[model samples]
Target: MNSKPVTRIKKINMYKISIIGYGNLGFHLVNHLSETGHKITQVFTRDKTKTRISKNKIDFIDDLELLRTDADVYFLPVKDDALKEVAKQLSLKGKIVAHCSASVEMKVLKNCTENFGVFYPLQSFSREVEVDFKNIPILIEGVNKETSSVLNDIAASLSNEVIEVNQEQRLAVHVAAVFANNFSNYLFSVAEEILKKENISYKILLPLIEETVRKVKEHAPSKSQTGPAKREDDKTIQKHLKFLSNKKELKNLYTIITDQIKSKK
Candidate 1:
């Protein structure tokens, strides 16, 4: 493959940008991009009510055909399944089309436009909480040299780490991310439930949680792991299981995850 470094755009002029979706990722992306001096010319959402806040700044287009063709880049931050179909219908020719889905390959844009690439932001986004773009990592993948350069420049302007990734490698990283982020959050949710049942405030786990994450930053996860599971203390494991007797599902999950961790060791 091509190993050339992508060129960076020194100055960002007024370029018409269209965000196709208004979901969690899309909404936050528009807000983030807007703060970086990039103009959001239009925002297309299935529901008109979602555009209530940005109605003045962005022209909400319901009809796909009515979408302004003057946009320099079309950022599709929609779900994975709807991406290709939406691209096909829009038929955005002579414009750059990029997607934020981590698992989606660059080939998905072949039917819509030649100037296509991946503009994946490595962060967990939610409508409730605002994201800091400066701390987030942006991974970009482009079909051609020019498109790659343009996306790299755009990403670099907003984030500290901007790197080019291929489709296969991106998918792999995305899979790893699910385990690292999503699965870990689920574990926290389980812990919260357990604490609530015991008439204990979840705040009590905050320091332990913070320290666990901090330790991982300094040492490998395996090396930093503590508790009965890591020490192979069967008596302690049995006591924990006995304590969680009322919650069979959580007990099983804890046992399974602990077993996996032990095997890894």
Candidate 2:
């Protein structure tokens, strides 16, 4: 009797990628992409000297002229305001060009390539902080089905949560994120400022913040609401407004938010 040999299948297909920005999102994308066995051919930044040293030996270039055209995907993780201008310089006709902006439309890359799309990560990114790529929701939008499939495969390789979203849907998610993440963070900063004025440590709010987030995770934010505004506690709300009286801007902001919260209830 003769024995048959077995063959192994590669789960993730390797892609050659070129990142056009070295900012926070770009930095993390580069690290994760490289770690996932993708070959980063080049990385572009305004000033390569200012960026942290690359351990992946990625060719960092300042000039767009130096950009290599060999990569399969060109990732533009630049600021939303500068995404268009930076993309205008690229002339990769057949290669896939993608932007990581939550607000920007995918049509911005229409003229750049035939296979252009968006590879937006839902979570906020910062250069100093470390995050797990697998946990983040990657929202992908391609010009067509074939283009979308390619992006979907790539996004799946990086994240456990991958969704195929259209421009309109992506914009909706972005707006919701602004409310949930950015607005909440700003409120946290306001809380910190209030504590600072009273010579109290902002760390005192950490446990409360954590518990609030935990409750929201298990239930809808509306269902988890337990604040003075949510409870319609006019006395406490008035007291808070009185405390913020010296800071007219804060008082106005508080009033606006309190009214909004109460209205939602």
Best by lDDT: 2
RMSD of each: 6.2, 3.4
Backbone Cα, N, C clashes tallied per candidate: 0, 0
Return the lDDT, model 1, position 254: 84
* Number of clashing residue pairs, candidate 1: 0
- Writing each residue's lDDT as its tens digit, candidate 2 over 1-265 gives 5878879865877799999999888899899999998889989999766465666677888999999899998989999999889878889999999899988988898888989999998888877788999999999999888778878888888999999998889999988998888898999999999999899998999999999989988999878888899999999998988988899999999999889999997
TM-score to native of every candidate shown: 0.87, 0.90
Model 2: runs farther than 4 Å from truth? Answer: 1-10, 50-52
Q: Which is the leading candidate under TM-score?
A: 2
Q: List the residue pairs that clash in candidate 1.
A: none
Question: lDDT of each structure?
Answer: 0.86, 0.89
lDDT of 2 at 4: 86
Name the weakest run of 10 consecutive residues (lDDT summed) in model 1: 8-17
